[model samples]
Target: MSKTVVAVFSSRGRAEQAVSSLREAGFNKEISIAAKGEDHKGGRGNTDYFGATMAADAGDGLSDGVAAGGLLGGLAGLAVGAGALVVPGIGPLIAAGPIAGMLSGAATGGIAGGLVDWGIPEAEGRQYEEDVKQGRILVSVQASDNKADEAASILKSQGADRVKTH
Candidate 1:
């Protein structure tokens, strides 16, 4: 699988610094930086909001699964899996019942779908989003497992105080 590893920095400049270091470390062509406000819509469309909302819904769905294990679980599951709710040829199946099924199915499908959407594995994407919400910057790289350590090493060398690999 093509994997993306992200290194979180404290500031946009620090992220840039890490990018520069990554370039020097031989990942120049593959590295990219997501600077704040660089791709903003002046408060209209917010990627962060979307990402965070998705994470929250997923979390809620998981919590519901642990709580009720039936109807609520299905509802929570749907909310969590809302990001992957797509209809091919037909329109969206917006009914609560089916939506709940989609959410319930998320326990399995959401993982792969989320990974595909975030460009990282499902577990990694959740963790990354959590870290970002806590005010940390994320640096992601896509490569083989062997290269993950080296990429992490470079980020840490450039002042990434805390690093998590998934």
Candidate 2:
């Protein structure tokens, strides 16, 4: 199965730089960057924005979709919760097959319809909301399991401060 990985950088410039390095490292098509931070007044603005953005982006891994079932989910949840107090939201729920199936059923009704209409569960939805509230940026990548490790390694080599693999 294909998995997603996220790399968090300290600044937009660093993030962009990492992207460039990642590309050179052979992960050109698999990397992305998001600038996170709060808008504020004067010099405080820059600091607040960078801090908020980092928290938000870093906290994203614990949300529902990113962390569903298995070890990855648990680790993501713990990491997010501990790092930023963000809860796992729809991301995790949708990733969890049972919850996703239930949400699909609630949305459409029939098993076939439910199967076709994928959705995350309520609990997970709530978790996503919490993650956002914490003010974090999110970077997502979809790649095969084997590629995930390499992608993460490339991001790290390129100076990604925090890299999460799922």
lDDT of 2: 0.37
User: Which regions of candidate 2 deviate over 4 angstroms?
Assistant: 37-138
lDDT (Cα, tens digit) per residue for candidate 2, span 10-76? 4445554555555565653343322222333332111233232122122333232221221322212
The lDDT for every candidate, in the order shown, is 0.41, 0.37
lDDT of 1 by residue, 1-166 (tens): 5445667677645565675666566664344332111112222222221121211122323223121221212211222222222222211111122223433355344323333454556666555445544445455555577877888887787787566555
For candidate 2, give the lDDT of residue 115: 24
Q: 44, model 2: CA deviation in Å?
A: 24
Work out the TM-score per prediction: 0.44, 0.39
Residue 64 accuracy (lDDT) in model 2:
21
Give me the displacement of residue 11 in model 1, in angstroms: 2.7
Compare the candidates by lDDT and give the number of the best one: 1
TM-score of 1: 0.44
Q: Model 1, which residues run further than 4 Å from truth?
A: 1-3, 35-124
